[model samples]
Target: MIEVSDPNEIAALARDPNLDRRFETPTCPVNWLLLKRSLKVLSFRGHRFPTMMPRDDAQRTSNQQDLWNLLGEKVASIKTGSDELEPLADWVRGIGPDVQLGILVQQLLGQLFSSKFMATEASWDAAKVLVAAPRLNNLPLMMWWFVSGKVRRAKRLLAGMVNEDLSAVNAIGIAVHNVVKSLRQMRVLYANVQTRSGLSAEAAAEQCLFAPASVYRQATAAGQLGDCPYSRHSLFVLSIGEAARHAEGRSLVFMEDSWSRCPANLWIPAMLQGVWNRASVFSQFHDEKLSG
Candidate 1:
């Protein structure tokens, strides 16, 4: 493990955030290898695009081509899975966007053990590399096979270094997954009292007026009935009751967390209810009485 000898060094790097861009001048081991990997992943499943995956491209610029060749050589030389990551991660952090590199490193480390979702046979070497992977996404991927019986895909905007509490990362992953899944449906979007500082459950209730009655009902029923602080700029979705009553294709509203001042956790259940409501409506429309 490369011990960061000085917090000041990282702090200094943060202070001049533009320092990463200096790599544009180009050099050997050109950071483009990490860049290409990051771009590949981002283009594939990132919010920005849907079609993306690994492939060979002869059209890549000379610098990018050189990096690709270097990566192939390094990957070929790497025996232990553990040996493939640290240097790659370090190189990633040194050049290219940190967020992008973090995602790629996490994906690479996860892929090393299993193609994507399956867990590799237990290997001490793979476990060690996963333990030291740079992102929380990697942690959850590692835990899925090793810890939990659930083989769910990891879905959190963790975007940075691995947090100290691995459980917290898991919780956040579950939370974000629930939230995004809810958004895809016409479920209720919840709000909270989060800030750059922190949040309180009490704050969640006090500002609950902005939420729909159904959302409040779900929140109250779940015993999640309080205002909790959320990210400064969070968006939520709520189904339109009138739209559902009319049997419309879909109905939802996007609102800001700050404006609603409600608990964000309530969003998931609200979504469940909306989906249930839509299903009920659909069944009624079909009028297919059961013979039972």
Candidate 2:
């Protein structure tokens, strides 16, 4: 396995035709088995999570492009200053000063998935298990979790909450969790900023837009990406979140220019900005009421 964190190298490697999302049979038998298990945990009812599907998957490509176009329409509408997100902003504003940050963010993002979506305390508990299952590096423990039905239960709860929409599952299950983490970070930064009024909502949102921690690719054949050399079936771990920390690495947040770029690139930042804007307004009003 090769781990890459440099922005330029990641960009070059991500665009390389030889490297793709499909996990080919690795040279190591143990690794190959582990990859198969990973795919199992990441899939539901025979459908691989959209993000986990191979690049060459025609159905995935077509469906994802449709989602992208839909998100683009949402972005355009949002840009017109609609009040569609005021409810979410109000939820953020109403958060108790000492509320559990993780749970609060998860609940807030859950609303974005669907108005019918509701996260109970038990759901949050299950989510912890579900989100961590894919990241477990131990084969034995992973197998034990699966066999013991722990993983299956968590997945069932998640699927039920999202009405079995795989895209919603992927978004809430794998993607927006990082966005939640970053929003928490942004909240801390907003609180500590000496000149909060000077920070635009858009700027504040951009300050916390985080990329996924990493994405994997497999080489179909021996090839060189920048200075890195890889053999067939070698796995490449692109450290997207790390690269996004660099000055010019912001684009990596959404992989904005890449073939695999996130569909919600514009919509996410806009939604975040709207939340921060409403929250700031509420804060100012509360401060004035207290002072008066």
Candidate 3:
């Protein structure tokens, strides 16, 4: 596992032939590879189109710019109050203009994993997918699999690294899964601390490692939720970049953490900048993009 953060470094690793690949598997009878591929497709759709995976690309560039502009405004909303910080996840939710986009994204992903709903070898219990908050959306389906251990399989995001050299890189770090657990832990740790500093969670984390007791307390108090004050920011940024890369058919950023740079560190600005490049010219628009 080569620890790497630089895009150039990761690109170098991508050229390596010895690199292995892996992904989390569904715990039930669902086909893991199929599910992964399906999610990848949905991710591509969500990132590529803002209007519930629209087929019209007449304003691709303008549309993307609009989305980003909207995103920027929403991000700025966080700094509007005296808090100067806001939950990243909630902020991302407030950006998109399309309300059905969430449903479309989930349904598409769910349908991709549809074999599980059948009586085939991949069949699962119907009770597992009640039409409720989670199952009503694929979020519940995904959560069920998380506990079942389907998505826990670790995959190497960087192409160039090997297992023996995971410790040598300065830009590398492990990605901590169990996001909610980590955030809740942070809540307990910083239940009664002040946060006026604008340093990001990443900064506070580094400070916590070797700072004095006063600094440790300050760092821990960075936020009441998330892994740090900017955990949501990290999540949003990482998800966008990962979805874009994965959508491009390069699954480099969606894997579990290793001794080296967490997959999130890899720089893929295209994910953010290419917000509205018209959809592929060769491909016809898709209307039946997803089915739950």
Candidate 4:
């Protein structure tokens, strides 16, 4: 892992798979975006990269423009299965360090959340969001980003529901009742997830964490009650903890002592229900697990 301070050094390391932590301390957001975009181009085709390193600033500027042009073309043609989507998807997933795609995704997600995209009422604006979304669908990196967004959205929706008036509360209660009913059906499917083909829940959960699989497995497998500060079914629980910390605008490590570490409450029942709903649908529709 290279802890590069120079923008040029960062760009140089983008092509190499040896470095695990590509973007180091005090992350330069613009440099990170360019590196991610450049890596995607390299993954799509090795020969697309410049054959020689530019000697002068002018040449470097031209090369940077070339890279940007390539990214524009790729992002523009990134339609779903319209000939460019699969290749782009493959390129993003195939990039080295396995974190480049995640970086690109989080860059886009940050833009989506901070920019006016989420609040856009125009259908064409929403359509543009969908196009970018489908390009990374079903990929592990994309799933992590999506799950992060889903968890955030679920919390926001839950909070709004609880904060509303009586009529709104009644409506929210009805929605919750239906979700509970759906979850009962899904729990049956979770029981068979290990035996079924395609992606397993454990595998999905593994991808959600920022830690090693062994660490996660050890934590979940131990299942020692009150052994740690908090109880967690799996390592992925840490993601929820991190997300909650971010939402509260505090350090994630600090919350570990309270809500994250051995907190006795499974207060995320609605979020869990949403996961079950999606899991069951994917298994039944894509994995053919529910067929007679």
Candidate 5:
């Protein structure tokens, strides 16, 4: 078990069998038209994202174009029962890593929030003004540029997200309610994440996914959580801290574990090679885990 930490190594790990790449649930449902109209009422029109996503007729909560549908088409086209990996690799390889990261980051943010890519708000309070749920969906948009390949574009998008007065009081519990284990440990775990490693956005996103799985797991245990976090019929507490341990790459081994770490969350880093890809970014850390 190689704990990958090297950036180049991490990028290479994207193609690894252990990295799960899929979004198993639906997003929080919001009326795209109504949300847009509400933005005007709240004067968020100026802060709006320019990217336009095509909505699925069935998924009313979604505002971004579904990629697994587009990308999955490629996956489905592969001949089943064939051991050939090149076809799948070819599909992933066809897309630019930066573009792949951009699509993924925008999709992740869109899933957690809605309608567009990254944007800004007046403050944490102002940030949640009209959104439906709240969670730390705004982590590491700055680093998304390198993996996403559109540095200037990523930078411009990140500008709107920076709230000078952002805080836990105003930041949590509104707009983007999907949670991450990192948020609970932010003051300690994530605040000092840099000391442990370079702290890439890809790593941040990858490590945070296991928390959602724990949330879903507990919900299953008590029979209290939603059908799924991404489901419209799903209803439950959308908070973090319940899951502190990594899912230990279980998602890579089973599609069911994909829910634990949303594919949107995993895909960006996987493409960026900071997680389960073969490049083995955390080789140092992974070695200890396997040996210890």
Candidate 6:
């Protein structure tokens, strides 16, 4: 396994056709077995999660592009003052001062799906399980996680909740969870800086938007990324958030200009800006009331 933290190398590696999403080969046989077992948790029935699909998969690519186009429409409407933004902003403002992560996740899920999106405590637990399953290093626990039907039960609970395509359900749940967690981090940062007078909502959102920690890819052929030489089956762990610390690396946060760039790059910041706009107004009103 190779860990890549440099921004340029990470971007170049991501664009390499030979480096795809398949996790078929691991540096060691033990990991190979573990990865295979863990992948079961990310699947619904026999369908792999959309994010786990190989780039060359025609159907997955088409479906992802369709989702991107749909999100683009939403972003466009938002630019023209869609009514949806205020309600979402209000919902975000309503998050408590010290809400638990699970509750925050549940609320965010509702915002992403329908307000009537049925999610239980177990549903959130199951999503957490799926996210962590890929990193499990304990052989016995990994075996139990799959053998005990825990993975199947979790997938069953989430499958078809979003759409008939099980992959869509898994994809939405995982993406929402990840984005919300990053937003939460941004919220903390925003709180520290929001008191500065005349801070625009756009500036606040841009200052606070946190990047994802890392992403993974597997090599299908030998390649040299930067000065690093990697063989086929080499696993590359790209540290995205770390790379984003540098000015040149900011684009790594959303993978800007890359084929795998996040579709919601514009929408996410806009949502954050809306929330900050509402929250700032509320804060000012409260301050005036106190002063009076």
Global lDDT scores for all candidate models: 0.27, 0.74, 0.25, 0.29, 0.29, 0.66
User: What's model 6's overall lDDT?
Assistant: 0.66
**Candidate 4 per-residue C-alpha lDDT over 11-33 given as tens digits, one digit per residue, 9 for 90 to 100:** 22222232221212222454344
Candidate 2 lDDT tens digits, 1-292: 8889999888888789988878765458755775776687778888778877788788887877887886776765564335765554554554544235445555555665678776666666666776788788876897799999988787788788887777777776666577666667656755653645778877878887888888888888899866667789988888998999998889999888777878788888876776677667777898899999
Clashing pairs for predicted structure model 3, backbone only: 1-162, 1-163, 3-260, 13-160, 25-150, 60-276, 172-260, 172-261, 173-260, 173-261
Selected candidate, larger TM-score, 5 vs 6: 6
Query: What does candidate 1 score on TM?
Result: 0.18
Worst 10 residues of 2 by lDDT: 93-102
TM-scores, all candidates, are 0.18, 0.87, 0.24, 0.19, 0.27, 0.82
Expressed as tens digits, the lDDT of each residue in 1-292 for candidate 3 is 1123333334433333223122223322333433333333222212321211222234543544443454344332222221211222222223323332233222212222232211211111111121121222366666665566442221122101222122111011111112222233333323223431233443332222210000000011112221223211111111223232323323334221221122222211221111111111101133235331
How well is each residue in 44-110 modelled by candidate 1, as lDDT tens digits? 1233111111112222233233433543444323422233344332332233332333333334333
Q: Residues 56-163, candidate 5: write the lDDT tens digits.
A: 223312322253343234332222212232222222223233223322322333323233334223222232332322121443642342246433232233334433
* Alpha-carbon runs more than 4 Å astray in model 6: 76-116, 164-167, 193-198
Which one is best on TM-score? 2
Q: Candidate 1: lDDT over CA atoms?
A: 0.27
lDDT for position 12 in model 5 = 28
- Sorted by TM-score (best first), the order is 2, 6, 5, 3, 4, 1
1 or 3: which has the higher TM-score?
Answer: 3
Give me the runs in candidate 3 sitting further than 4 Å from their true place: 1-8, 11-36, 39-64, 82-185, 192-292
lDDT of 3: 0.25
Candidate 3 residue 86 Cα shift, in angstroms, is 9.6
TM-score of candidate 3 against the unseen true structure: 0.24
Q: How far is 195's C-alpha from truth in model 2 (Å)?
A: 4.0
